[model samples]
Target chain A: MTRLEDMVGAAVRDLADSAPNAHDLASVARVRGRRIRRRRQALLGAAAVVLAGAVITPYAVLDGWNGGPRPQPVASVPPSTAPVVPVPSTVATAPAIRKDWWAAPVRLPGDLVVTSVGRREVNGPNGVTAVAPKTVQEGNVALDRSTGRYRAFSGGYQGFDGAPAGRYVMTDDGITAQIGILDSVTGQTRQLGHGSGRGVEWSADGKTLLLSLLRGGVRLIDAKTGAAVDREMPDAIALCPSYCNFTWLPGGEEIAIAQRDPRVERSEALPDTVRDIRVFSVATGKPLRTLPVPGVPAGSAAWSPDGRYVALLPDAAEEDGIRIAEVATGRIVATLPLVEQVRFIADDQILTVRGLDVGVYDLTGKLRQSSRLPQDFLGRGISLGRA
Target chain B: MKQSLEDEFTAFVADRGQSLLRIAHALTGDRESAQDLVQGALAKAYARWPRIHGDAEAYVRKIIYNDRASAWRRPGRRNEVTVAEVPDRAAAGRHDQDVTDRIAVREALLSLPERQRAVLVMRYLEDRSVEETAEVLGCRPGTVASQASRALNKLRLLVGDRPVSMGGAR
Candidate 1:
């Protein structure tokens, strides 16, 4: 070997000499393999017989991986009407399974159908408190964190209006999507009418539905009584020449809007959009205080749960990481990876898909919990917050 | 069928996990990142078990190399190798061959572009032929040869030795 080649060999040998044995990695990889394979097969539907683990991990990762069966949509029958699921026979003898504070992931069978969003207090194994998705088998629902055991959870804006939780507006045929409210305690559906507007969004209080209409205006539909109120956008915010993206603030009284430059035609250039962000009052339908958030591209603004900050994904000329800027200061406090797949899971914690993993991180940018799904899970549409 | 497939996957990891981890460490220069890379590749492998089960290790190794290369390119996410700037010249013919020097050598190797570093690892420590490295990297044999050459020359400069010590002390 040449001198450099020999030197390279020496360096590699030195560095690798202290490497750890792969026994631990093997165990973890086996688990990851089973979970991801099940997720991939989830696209093919539940007819394929993927074996359940002897003692399924409680909080392994990726909350909803449907390996067993797709629950059918049974809206008329009450959730308790379906046959009760006996505890997994192995629970007593099975080894310890990892637990997440949120929920214990179990293989969902085809029978525990959920027709709409319901507010049933599901106490997960090991103190995981949740508004369980309306399911016949509340004790044995699937791992989908967004809609728990929701079956008619056909389609909605993912993570946009925080759908698929207690209440969700969904469209199966693409032409219409209605918002459904459920009792979080009983897991029973409340007959909220089909919100008659495009881009339907649930209010923070879950009492009102905010929808954007194509005819050029926004509407507020009562989620409980199905009352409708329409509001037209001021000409300044309307006429989406380039594009428009907006999100409701926590109080549900205001919205943060980003309107791109109508004249530039190209989307990325700083000149293509308004220099200052336009905040509009939902009650008045007029532009409120305008904050300077220059160079923000179209459709990249998501408000934090606390309404104190807006998370912005990187624009063309900016660094490629998620930037969280305080709405009051417009000063960016943190920049993190997972720009495209980021949602504020809590006031301080964000849920993100990094590589094959779905991880939860706190405001201090500390990774609190992370679980890997399949590599193409995002592309294959592993259900997240909304859609 | 599920148990059998899992058994096959478990067997593959048990047999080859250690060697793969070693390769990952050498490529990434850190245990955590190596584990991350390996887990990622293995997840992909598991996703496509039926088609590539016959030759899963090779497939995963290929993934590792490709991902390491791309990791170097991602904006604001690349592993920045922060090294004390190398001296312009080693004190004439009096460089000490100690632990510090070993560490410097490791840093110098890691400081190389990820593809170049991976090429050197494949060609030298892994003892792969130019063609094999090319196959793993999905590039021409000549490209692997060139990257290996550049990597070695850069290493020689940074490590400050004409014929660096190949002793296993480090």
Candidate 2:
């Protein structure tokens, strides 16, 4: 035998000798056995129940009757007297139902068009707020597809529901002006800050707030004092004359913004073609670097942990795939093939909603599992948590 | 209904689970993942017990092979390769000769493609006939022969020129 063969044989033998505890194996077997037993029992019980129902139903029906003799049936009307109305196949056709109807009832509060919705749980002395019902909204704004319109509807009330108590920030009219802190016990909301912006992100420690100004640069605000920090992004970075979106990393030290560059591109209307992802130091507002996403026409960008990768998805009409760019090298690492829309579950896993099935796949292209959603929940967004 | 079948299953797992795990470990190259793969295969067999019990071992083996194959075809799914740590030569001195040999074989196995590796394990390690391996893999016997031939040739190159004696063989 060669050295490699000898070595492999040795490892296999060693693994067998020091095999892990049988507990896991036994547990798996036991679970399988239980499932088999339950299914068998259910089948047998169902068969017996059907048999019993068949035997007893006729007797019960006979016992309920007082009179045994029955009369013959009588004819009601002749065919000639009925109206001779012609039926048009075209007129009988049902109106085309809008595909967005099922998703219509979920409305966002008025005065606040929902920019995004994230599911979170808050924990407190109230013994874990009942995992809010499936339909409960987490963020403000209801985006309706019915009339292809965005309307603000009420009903999204933020509260502590088994999540760690913290002050949650909200943005108004693209400004970070209003902040609400939920009371851990009473589940009451208290206002904190006054700022306006399209986007707001809380720091990792929940001590600092980051907001993007609609006309220009980003602003860092003290979460407690509601005061703007002296640090403002440089004019070069702040040159976005129209729309800007900000995404924060977990560490809170950095934020990435997707904005149009006014200097490089100019148009009478907002230049739809101009888009870029720029990293900035949250404390200094100094631009760190601008990374261009390949294959992505650039509309929205989100950062992965360590800011090593950014996920870019174009507008709704564009084909879907996520581009991963290495921050240091700015080279494309991988372009994840996905359906029209996908939600990142973690750094490694993505939950993709395709048709009626929700597929879970790891970063490396392995499909872990898939589950079908109910018809009503088909068009609605899905949120996942450890059960 | 039969105590004997249950006992047989327990003994089968005790006797053959390691061998199955070795093949799975070779394919995934991770102990935890191999265990999951084995359990998943066994679960699938259990679900079809009435039909599978007659050939339970073969049924489970087929499931493991198919699952691993299907996983490789998914688009944009990347496989995370986790290599087992190589113990220091001095520390490994106390291990049995056979144990060390098995480890070397597993590492070499990991270098092969999913199909080639499965063919090798089923034919050489499990001592299955070419027809039997082909049946398990759902391929023609001729294809199995060709795959096994290619896999063995690759293994010869991977195992290198060092000579060692098989503990129980001539």
Evaluated with TM-score, which candidate comes out highest? 1
DockQ for every model comes to: 0.15, 0.09
Per-residue alpha-carbon lDDT of candidate 2 for residues B35-61, written as tens digits (9 for 90 to 100) = 656765665455555555778777777
Q: Which DockQ-derived CAPRI band holds candidate 1?
A: incorrect
Off by over 4 Å in 1: A38-387, B69-80, B85-95, B98-100, B161-170
Summed over model 2, clashes come to: 48
Error of 2 at B65 (Å): 48
Off by over 4 Å in 2: A1-185, A192-197, A204-207, A221-230, A234-243, A259-276, A292-301, A315-320, A333-347, A351-359, A364-368, A371-387, B1-170
For residues A1-387, write the lDDT of model 2, one tens digit per residue.
Answer: 444434544543443344333334534654545443443343333211111100000000000001223211111111132222222112111122234522433221111111222222222332222232333333222233334332332223331111101333232221122434333223244454533222344443445555544323455666455566544443432433122345554345556655454445532111123345566676677777665533221212134332344444432112224454444444544455433234333334444444234555444444555544333332222221111
Put down candidate 1 lDDT per residue, A1-387, tens digits, no spaces. 554455467888876664554545655565556654554343234323222120110000111211223221111112222221222221111112233312332211211111122122233443223333433222212233344432322222111122323343322121223334434334344444443222344454445655543333456767556677866553434323212334465445775555544454541111133344666677877776765554342121145544555555443223335666555555665566633245553345555543334555554455555554322122112223321
Worst-scoring 10-residue span by lDDT in model 1 chain A:
A54-63
List the global CA lDDT of all models: 0.47, 0.40
lDDT, model 1, position B143: 87
